[model samples]
Structure formats: C-alpha cells, structure tokens
Target: MNLQYKTIVVTGGGSGMGRELVIALLKKGAKVAAIDINKDSLEETVRIAGDYGINASTFVLDITDKSAVEETVKEMLVRLKSIDGLINNAGIIQPFAAVNDLDDKTTERVMNVNFWGTYYLTKTILPHLLTRPEAHIVNVSSMGGFIPFPTQTIYGASKAAVKILTEGLYAELKNTAVNVTVVHPGAIMTNITQNSGLGGPKVDNNDKNNMALSPSKAAQIIIRAMEKNKFRATVGKDAWFLDKLYRLAPKFATNFIGKMMKKSLAQH
Candidate 1:
C-alpha cells in the first residue's frame, strides 16, 4: 500500500525503531498516530516529530489493556478520520531462563506485551483498516520467531506465534487490498531489553556477532519491506543468517542457540 496521504499507527513509538519509523512515514507524507505506554517518551517523540509536521499525533496507551486499546482506536478514528495502517511494534523481551525457571508472572508479562499486545491492536484496528481503500499491518517479530533461542523461551515463543499469526492474517486477507508484513529482526541495539526490566541475567553485551544492526537501519529495512508488501523480512546479517540456518537445520540451529543461552546463564 502506498504510504502517501495515509494515516499510520505505530505502537511503541516513543523510542527505538518505532520512533524512527514515524519519522520515515512522515517523510513519505503519511499521517502518523504514535502510541506508547511511556507518556514522557511519547512527548519526546512528538516534540522531535515537530519538524516532521502536524500530521503526527500521539496516543498514550498500554496495548495489552483491552478497554484502553479499544477506546484509543475509537478516539483515533474520530481524530484522524481513519487508521490506514498499523505497525504492531510494541514488544518486550524476557531475560534468559528456561520456561520453568522464569516465574509464571514473568512469562505471562512477556507474552502479554510481545504477543497479546500485538494481537489486541491488530484485532482492534482491523475493522477500521478494512474500511480504507488500502491498509497495511506490519507485525514485528524477531529472528527468535523462526529459531528458538535458549533462555529467551517466552520471548521466542511469543514471536513465533506472531510469525504464524501474521501469516494467517496475510493469507486471510490475500484477496483484499489490505497487506500484512512480518519482520524478523536480528539483534539490534535498542531498549527492548533495558526498558522491559524483566528479571534474570541479561544477554552478554559483547555478542558482537549477533548485534549487527542499528535501530535506524532496522527501521529503514522495515519500511522497504512494507512498501513491497513483502510477507516476511529478515533484518541484519545475524538475523538473516539465522533465518537461513533455521530453515536448513532447525534442530542443530536451535541447539546452538540453546547452548549460548546456557553459557550466558552460567556466567550470570
């Protein structure tokens, strides 16, 4: 779908790739409703967006809150006239731990923000998106979506679900003008880890091989993929290589990742 003149909603727009995406969208002459749970960050995003134009709007919302999300959608339609596209980019990463090692609440929180939040926003805006002549839904999964990474079991599971859920949406809407794009981002330096404040030891800071892409680069790649209406995209060499490996050797590939997780856990 052409972004020009369309209204796009980007969750997690306060920072990271989402904020950059809002800037990119504005350059294409699209109206943007940038949402985040962090109101302070939202203000900062909107302030920075001033150079972009008046078309940028901010909505403070917790995507997992059903009533809040529903209400926000209603208000957005009334305010912006229409929601032409949605980028389900709000997500949190669980610290490395075996599923059983993570507390029940911890696992649920990860799933809620990473998977259910995406699902809620998609379901809420779907009706409004369908009303438009052309609509797009960009679901940001992760390399973990395609390949299981140790300790990140919940994070990986949620992304994997998003991968399949987004594909299902794409398949279901194939005949329509609406488009769905799923992204598998390799490790990029961003606050999905820091901001989440999830428990357990963090991933090693020196995993240079995996942390190849920057948020800005990731945002650009995402926009390009959405423009092509690509069904799936893998960002960064780490992510790209992982996707290929996952497809060619699912068992061994995951095993390697599992070992990495174990090492990280042992270090912690």
Candidate 2:
C-alpha cells in the first residue's frame, strides 16, 4: 500500500528505529502518531523532526497496560483523524543471564513489554485498521527471536512470540484490507541497552566488520517491506544470513550460533 498521505502509529517512537520510522514516514508524506514511555524522548523526536514535526503527534504511553493502550489508541485516532498503519516496535531486553539465573520480575517485564504490549496494541487498533480502505501492521521481532542466544533466552522467547503473532495476523488478514509484515532485525545501533537498564553489549561499535545497522537504514527497509506488502523481512546481514542458514540446516545453525554466543560471552 502507498504510504503517501497515510496515517501510521509507531510504538517506541521515543528513540531508536521507531523514531527513525516516524521521521521517515513524515518525509514520505505520511502523518505519524509517535508513542513512547518517555515524554522527553518523544519531545526530542519531535524536535528532530523540525518542520515535519507538525505532521507528527506524540503520545506518552505505557503499552504494557491494556487500559492505557486502549485509551491511547482512541486518542491517537482523534488526533490523527484515522489510522492507516500500526507498527508494534516497542520492546525491552532481559538482563544478560541465563533463564535460571534471571528473576521472575525481569522475565515478566521482558514478556510484558515485548509480547503483551504488542498484543494489546494490535488487538485494539486492528478493528480501526479493518475499517480503513487500506491499512498495514508491522511487528518488529528480533533475529534472536528465531536464533537462541544463551544469555538472552527469555528475550528471545518473547520476540519469537511476536514473530509468530505477526505471522498469524498476516495469514488471518490475507483477504482483508489490512496488510501485515513481520520484521526480524539483527543488531542495530540503538540505546536499547541503556533503555533496558543494562550495560552495552561487548561488541565494538567502531568495528566496521561488526558494526550494527543504523536505525535509519533499518527503518527504510521496514517501510519498503510494508509498501510491498511483504510477509516478512530481515533488517541486517546477520539476520538475513542466519534466517537462510537456519532454514537450510536447523541443527547446524543452532550449534553455530551457540558457539558464537559462547565465545562472545567468554570475551567479557
């Protein structure tokens, strides 16, 4: 579907790819309702948008709260007039530890933010989207969703749930006006570590060979996928490569990823 003049709602719009997605959509002649838990960050996003900021609306919302999500969606529709798209991009990672070592609170927080948050927003907004002549829904699922990371097991599970949820939506909405796309992003240069209240990953951001994809680039890829009505898309080389490898040889791919994670953890 064409994004021009469309109104799209993006969660996690305070920063990272979600912020970039908002900016990109505005530049493409679409209106955006940017939602985040941080008012300051949302303001920064609006400020960065400059003149295009007028086409963007900000909502400080905790998507994990079902009631909050319901009210926020209603407000967004009132502000934006109508909703043409929804991007479930908000999520949080668990602390770097095995599932057995992690506390219940941390696990629940990750699941709540990553899975339930997406579910609530989708459930509430889908009815509105169905009423539109044409609409789209994009869910951001991590590459870790499909490939297990030793220290991020719970995080991976939550994202895997998102992956499946989006896929199911796509299948169910096949004959409908709403289009669904699931995105699997590899490592990206974002402040998710700080946002999740954890230290940065051990990887060097300056290393050209290992550098993560820029948020802007990832956003562009996602928008393109939505325009084409793709069932799924990967945002980085690592995600793309592993997705193919895993399909070709699940055991070999899993073992390979396990060894890589083990080595990376050992380095720190």
Candidate 2 lDDT over 1-268, as tens digits, reads: 8999999999999998899999999999999999999999999999999999999999999999999999988888777789999999998888879888999999999999999999999999999999999999999999999988888999999999999999999999999999999999998988898888787754345677867898899999999999999999999999999999999998999999889988988887
Give each model's whole-structure lDDT: 0.88, 0.93
Judge candidate 1 at residue 111 and give its lDDT. 92
* Candidate 2 wrong stretches, greater than 4 Å: 201-210
TM-score of each: 0.93, 0.96
In terms of TM-score, the best-performing candidate is 2
lDDT top scorer: 2
Task: Output the lDDT of residue 224, model 1.
Answer: 90
lDDT of 1 by residue, 28-71 (tens): 89999999999999888778777775789999999989999999
lDDT of 1 at 255: 88
Mark the 10 consecutive residues where model 1 has the least summed lDDT: 198-207
TM-score (C-alpha) between model 1 and the true structure = 0.93
